[model samples]
Target: MQLDHVTLVTHDLEGTCRFFRDIVGLDDGPRPLFRVDGHWLYANGRPVIHLVDATGPARLSGGSSALVAPRIDHVAFRVAPGVEWRALVERLAAHRVPYQLTEVPASAEVQLFVALAPGVVVEFVTSLPVGAAA
Candidate 1:
């Protein structure tokens, strides 16, 4: 099955949206009416990131504590090489977001990691053409 989307419960909803929009190149788009406040971030016309407002009085069912940070290591997105990859890296740098870059061993793929929030990190991966520099 293909991945649908990722949900983030955050007290800093606007800040998180800014990070996704300005840094990750996602657009803040339409979201259906729900009890709580939030935003849906879309990429390529698909809502890939869902943000939930943790500071709101409304609580989700199942008694899940939004204050407790998720244990996810990182969310990864495969990006196009060359211009797309370079532009993403440039945006991260321009925004002063700290990121680590590394290449896969014996492969043409490179990965960049950025800590998006407490206990939340995002990874961008791209495969470079043979003999092309990252």
Candidate 2:
């Protein structure tokens, strides 16, 4: 089955959106009328990342990203083979966002790691042919 979406529990909703928009190159997209604050980040006309504000009425209280450990270490997205991986890397560098790259074992995917927030890490992976890195 194809991956649908990755949801993040965040206290800084707007900052999270900016990170994905500016660094990840995702654009703001439509989201259903849920009784919460969040943003739908779209790529190729599909919502890939969903950010939900877990902040309480205080909005700055001990909640979500703040009051608990990050539930997920990272969320990964598959990039097409033709994507400009170099340019993407440069964009991240330009923003001073820390990231690392490594090859996936037994697969041709190259994984990129970036800490999106205090407790959030996001990954972008480029799919390669079998033995491509060999």
Candidate 3:
């Protein structure tokens, strides 16, 4: 089966929205009113990322350094080919967001890894070539 969207908890709603919309280049859409505190973003009619405001003030999942752990990972989105990945890297740099480019096997596709915040990491991947692993 194909993968669906992923939700993340964030304290800054507006900032998170801006980061995903402006920096990441995801189109912003109207967020439906949910009982809880949060917002949603979609790409091609599929909800890709959902942001939820953490309930109350508690210590972060595993403190600020937790993200550095070996098991930590981020969500990645594949973009169409012929798209400029470096321009995205430049956009991240212009926004002062730290990132790296990693190449995966077989198709030789590249992924732009961008850490939006202390515990939030997202990647923009080059679309897989024809006949590549799905």
Q: Using Cα atoms with residue i matched to residue i, what is each candidate's TM-score against the true structure?
A: 0.85, 0.76, 0.70
Clashing pairs in 1: none
| Candidate 1: tens digits of C-alpha lDDT, residues 1-134 | 99899998788999999999998899999999999899999999999999998864444457775544335577899999988999998998899999988888899998899887877889999999766777
The weakest ten consecutive residues by lDDT in model 1 span 64-73
**lDDT (tens digit, per residue) of candidate 2 on 32-72:** 99999899999999998999997653233455444434377
Deviation in Å, model 3, residue 89 alpha carbon: 2.5
Mark the regions of model 2 whose C-alpha exceeds 4 Å error after superposition: 57-70, 81-83, 105-107, 127-134
The prediction achieving the highest TM-score against the true structure is 1
lDDT, candidate 2, at 62: 58
| Every candidate's lDDT | 0.88, 0.81, 0.71
Ranking by lDDT: 1, 2, 3
Report the alpha-carbon TM-score of model 1 versus the true structure: 0.85
TM-score of 3: 0.70
Model 1 lDDT at residue 74: 79
The TM-score measured for candidate 2 stands at 0.76
**Model 3: residues with Cα > 4 Å off, grouped in runs:** 57-72, 105-107, 127-134
In order of TM-score, best first, we have 1, 2, 3
